[model samples]
Target chain A: MTQFNPVSQSAGGQASFIAVDWGTTNLRAFLMNQDGHIQAQRDSDRGMLKLGSAEFESVLSDLLGDWLTPDLPIYMAGMVGSRGGWQEVPYQQCPIKLEDLSEHLFWLTTSLPNKVAIVPGLRGTGVAGLLDVMRGEETQLLGALDWLEEQGRADESPIFCLPGTHCKWAQITEGKVTQFSTSITGELFARLNDESSLVKGLPKSNQLNEDAFKKGVQASLQAGGILHHLFSARSRFVCGELAADEVRDYLSGVVIGHDVNDTLEALKVVSLEVPKSPVLIIGSEALSERYALALSSRDLTSEFLAANEASIRGLKRLANRQAVSANNPTTGAL
Target chain B: MTQFNPVSQSAGGQASFIAVDWGTTNLRAFLMNQDGHIQAQRDSDRGMLKLGSAEFESVLSDLLGDWLTPDLPIYMAGMVGSRGGWQEVPYQQCPIKLEDLSEHLFWLTTSLPNKVAIVPGLRGTGVAGLLDVMRGEETQLLGALDWLEEQGRADESPIFCLPGTHCKWAQITEGKVTQFSTSITGELFARLNDESSLVKGLPKSNQLNEDAFKKGVQASLQAGGILHHLFSARSRFVCGELAADEVRDYLSGVVIGHDVNDTLEALKVVSLEVPKSPVLIIGSEALSERYALALSSRDLTSEFLAANEASIRGLKRLANRQAVSANNPTTGAL
Candidate 1:
């Protein structure tokens, strides 16, 4: 039931630490040296959704293996910190300084030396003053800011688009996350394609049909908005205008296109530089490129920072600040 | 496997015919006399979705029971005429006179008798020139139009909104369906409330929470569009701004509100009298009321007609034209 948080007696000299990006469907870990350079890495399907709350300790410990030393602190982000996850860490409110994430680290109360902690997610005011929340992506945002600072582009406020099942569009003012909105674009596409009558008999294909994808993006830019554009998939397919192999990608375009469009529109309501400002996409190369294509189709520029690297940089940044936070934690007592 | 279409020899003297509204999930039949009066009605869950193409005849015959007679013609509408239904009746293009439906009836070639036919669905160019398809809704639209004409409102080009699993918005100009669009509002709401993570831990209920539902409608009018508005359900729930019991209705509000908003916007792109014109809503009292609530919040005037009346009147209207069609069919041969 327990991986017995690595005994403090066995931990002497270790300049290494572990960073785990544990989300709903996937998990990845990194072992970094004193300089925040990756020494080793491991990836698994043991996501928080697949494990019971009690199993988190064991699964995580076995994952770390030799890397699981008491002095080698472990930091986790995403759904592992959610209510049904390992510890249910509370979210920190934003307009939050990305750098202050380490100060809000929720340390687990293990019997042995304390080294395990979850990077708290962020809850911020979204469009129309409604609330929005993000877990792992907040840490990724922290890491992305770190990556941008290294490139000396930190001062230039660019909208961060994290493309995934629940896509997020965040705006950074200075070093703090001023505001952000989440859209279930990917999930909606999946549900309609798989379950709804829209793509009932349509063959499913994973390959992206570039032409259809871009056409869908153009359709999304039209007057009907998404609900109408979505029907266009069924309508076009039935009319034999869109091919069987193109339905999936075309759907991807419609969904992501609206996501990009709606978010930009919402951002424009708050900031003047939105439509003009370039976007920094923090996600996988494949998906981020899709976002990039959707953006470029609208004549907007975008750059990608590998999502994994951003999370690692985010965790390392926190690890560096961990010592400072330990002496004088800014977070209120739970 | 065959229900053996009535042998025609059994005909004596019968003035009754069947009008079937057969859809994906349910089927209903009305035994109507020559005077357009319902003699009897039967309903079943044996929708087209439940039976194979070969089994339609048997199922219909069994449902008809003692009502089955060679002299009685059966006119069916909805998905029953879809490719996977009893027969794959092609869609009739729009800017089409609703009264012309009987001319396009897809008469099935029964060896014994030619009494079975499917009321063909309609195809129309929706927003951005995308082809939109509707199966049963076309017949319902016809019925609604007939009902309107009887009330001396034939010249009025009211937007016909049939809200259901796949809600449809139709514009009828000069007794013809000029344009229409289908929004996956109801289906989207069902999918998110049941399968998506947005309502993962939330309680489900059938009761409509007016406060929450209206809030969602109001939310849709804001800058972020439906995609952003959808996430508000989860975000608001997580922040304790929304209650568990209210999630479902609230979600319905958001989806239906967007459905109403998007379709109206698309209609305005072509028609000048859209937002100002009255909307004739053809659906059940309860569901139509929700739509009415959504419409009224935006200061739009709407009137409801029982969905069943619309379908029956539409079928009766077609029956009156069937003899005319038999003499000179307007539809090209399959």
Candidate 2:
């Protein structure tokens, strides 16, 4: 791999670029020089959910001002472009290239004189004939691809599972994300534990009780149907077997069981072979660990990737490509 | 029909009977004599979701003081016998008869001086099998059968649909419940509307907009998929085409759509040859209205039966039979 120097021929000197990945509940920003070295970073709770459209620009500008000057060019992604975000930028359908996204990009000039370009999220009609939506993850997947290409191991169509509030599994072929599916497993877990009667009497505990989760998973898999397994959760509690805290794990198992089942079923419809294939998981440590356990339960091998690293690397690759295109007008596709 | 009166029986001759129909969220009880007159009626918040095995008897006693007095025969049914309920009473498979239920009856009596018999819910397994769990409704269906027998309309196999929390469809042949299936349509609706994000932002109102509900039923019948029509409510809201309160109607549409789809699907599997058959719908007025609208949407006809009436009649029939069977060796099969 070639290492570029941290210098650029600006009229006076070198300057750093900023990349922001914004989601519903959080915002993460990365500052990189010309060489793709992370010079600074910032995070804030002024996410899309907290900041409605009217207050988004001011809140974001206030946060970014601490990290960089007002005139910096900022590239953003994630729910910042969603209907509920700063601007309602339409989604670019999947099997989409970076250039397709770049073409449909929305630029906003803040009163503080900063130039901001928000990356469009990807949307696609899945094989199941349902609309699948994603925002910041597509950019991260592109970055993972760039990293793989740098390593000279980017030939295989790797299954990238990005697990978070909304778990996304994308199939990357060559350098493009061909298709993906989203599961609301995390949100369902949170709601069931906090608001639902399924765990009404349960105690608060965050520790993953593998035994209880496994029991739930097994019961969910073996039960005749979804409704039957739902009752079993209550039955387990009533039978004096499951602790209140363990209900969370059981709920997780129920959701994961359904998710895996549906995903596998969807894959079969598309004739995608999963077993013995490489599965790449990207997310937080805890979620990745859970995914790993779930995969192992189904006798599948998986590789874990750090989500932050992937997103940063992806932004770096985007920056590099943009820089190269600026230098060679017709050589690099923008 | 023979009218037998037992008003002149001795004080001890009056058989004390306890009748109960324990549903998911409600429990109703009736104290009766040998003459099958409701001496007193009671209810409590001690539904299946609230109480467990340890508290079941105490809750019952608290609700019924004189009713639980010495020598009273307590008969109960509904979710109380479910696996998640107070006790794990095994299900009596479908094609079950009154005699079958009586033969396999399980009794639970404590030192509280009252005889208690918890009626078993129905269960069916194997290929093309179905299980219907009814505590109060089963007795209602039995009561309906007794009414039919008295009316000399017992020869025909009447199709009875009890639509409520769990909609039960039973085929009665020769005054016996030959087969029945339970659909958790009510529970599903409650969960989806109250808990799911599908209609999270929609306003709540109970006014039944029949026009919107009918439109939804039509769309459901034509489209044959739920998710497609689910977003109609949101779309209607976004486009300013629907009132905030009309969300109830939109919900009605989605649920009725599902109910119609499920009914049609189940009917297909069961291979009902006569589309214009005289189906009996026994349920609450609100649900019965919905069912009537659904049937009309499909160009099918049905006779509506009040759930409470059927249940009361059924309990009376049980009490009357018990009174006669105590004296006659073979008056009733049980």
Candidate 3:
């Protein structure tokens, strides 16, 4: 809810481009300089789900009213380019690099003067040879890789996790997204709280009980798999072992723990010592913290990155990559 | 949905008692003979959730309008005895038998003439020292044990699975319910289909797709646990590997498979061959079929019993036990 209006008079109205992360239920836009720093930022609840395909143009224009101008070069990512989004952009096949993303961008021809390009989401084989898709998180992963490079860890291919409703865990190998899987962890947690027996008589509280959460994480490590473990949230309550207020956080821990643990197991990452690189977690602060706790519980290390920052950086990176590719067409062609 | 109206004038109005299976969503009442045979049966949408505590008496009266008599005794099981139901019957601890249930029954002191008793639910240790509670399934389990006894398998300790909104798996040893676990498989499946991405665009059909379901069972045995396996339902659909209509059954398969698999693992009944006794699946035919299928897929054999029949048998057995205890207090005392 923090509004960042960094557009100052000293900049002399020299904003280079606009970066937008429009997902299922949220829209965040950033005005950046040529150096890829966010100069100003704005957000709204006008996610892709809220706007009709045709209304997207006007909504974007209204949101960025002060920043809009001819030839501003607008770049967008996430569900805004999905089938239910403004433009139904086909998913770009994975084993793709950050440099190749711009070439496969779904270019939107607009009545407005600005050239609009929506980054294509990625499609790849998930666990067990099943197909998985990610729209917005692919951009976040791209930005995370860039952040790693900036940290002089460019050679490191840490697993990048963008946790949200549908959490995406992508493995970056040799600067390319080689493997990834999507787990419906957040959505599942919300749904279980809303509908399952775990929250039946639970008292509502705004406090985040870390102890309860840690207990849940511990429960997840026990036998019976996730399905059986899920019932423990309520059963523990029924037995007077877990308090009403603690059930929610405990359930949260169980789910997040399983999500992290299972994904790692699927990737064949057995021990913390095996993976030399730390896991890179990119999401809202609250969600990332939970993932970090779960990872640490398993003795796996992780680094956090704010989702908004990653989105802006990724959009800017893609834009810059496209600009460079335009000058030398053969090099970055998809 | 088949209504059984078996009350006959030629029998000279000789109905013995009424056995009720009053759960969270539906109510089934059977008019029984002293021999425990159901002479007539009726059902309504007057589940525990549908009626207020004060309205339960009226609802029961309305459902059993013709069968009510001042001298007749009524026995009810399931959520009708839960905290929010007509009467909050306390749960009897595990390692209990059918004979002990009547002694623990929460007898109602009503303004109505007929004597009524709500069977106490059972509470027991589930997986990893966690507690599990079952309201109606205890009666089904009791009845299942009786059926086993009738089959000359009384000495055999078999796992009993009563599948429903919350499935209960009970281990009966020497006529006593020693341990049990409750898995929210049915509720989870229904919630996922209604609310999760797994069945977002799935087509509506009354048919149960066995092939699709079997495939899900196969997938459940693979790596990544239930949380990861859940996403495969949607991911497979996204990749055109699974059709919309097939997704529901597939999800059902995944959930049921995990439920059986996890519970077996928790009980340390690994490889099915370790337990010589076949799993006793007592529930509605539809649900029991699915559980049977899941068990068979794991090379675990199973037997089925009708829930209504089991409830009537259980109620009758408890009532007879109560009568004998009343006649000979010290001999039948718990």
Best by DockQ: 1
- Which one is best on TM-score? 1
Residue B28 error, candidate 1, Å: 1.3
Cα lDDT for residue B41, model 2? 82
- Better candidate number, 2 or 3, judged by DockQ: 3
lDDT of 3 by residue, A26-135 (tens): 88888887656877888999998778898999988889887777646788999998767898887888888865787887777777666678888888976655678888
User: Sort by DockQ, best first: what order?
Assistant: 1, 3, 2
Against the true structure, candidate 3 has what lDDT?
0.79
lDDT of 1 at A125: 89
What class would a CAPRI assessor give candidate 3's docking? medium
What are the lDDT scores of the predictions, listed in order? 0.80, 0.64, 0.79
lDDT of 1 by residue, A170-287 (tens): 8888789999888888788878878877787777766778898998898889877688788788778888888877877888888888988887777778775554557999998989
- Candidate 3: clashing residue pairs, number: 0
Compared with the true structure, what per-residue lDDT tens digits does model 2 show for residues A117-184? 67777766443444567788877787677666677776766678888766787876656678776665
TM-score of each: 0.93, 0.71, 0.92
> Which segments of candidate 2 are over 4 A away from where they belong?
A1-15, A33-37, A172-174, A236-247, A272-276, A296-299, A326-334, B1-191, B205-310, B324-334
- Candidate 2 residue-wise lDDT, B1-334, digit = tens: 5343332253744746777877778888877665566777899878988777788888888888876665666767777877667676776656667534555445664556766666666553211242234455667787677666677866656568787655666776666666565554565457667765446666676668887777667655532134334444444453455666765576567666556555555556665454545677888888888878887776777777677667666656654555555432231122
Residue A186 lDDT, candidate 1, scale 0-100:
78
Off by over 4 Å in 3: A1-13, A269-274, A327-334, B1-13, B269-273, B327-334
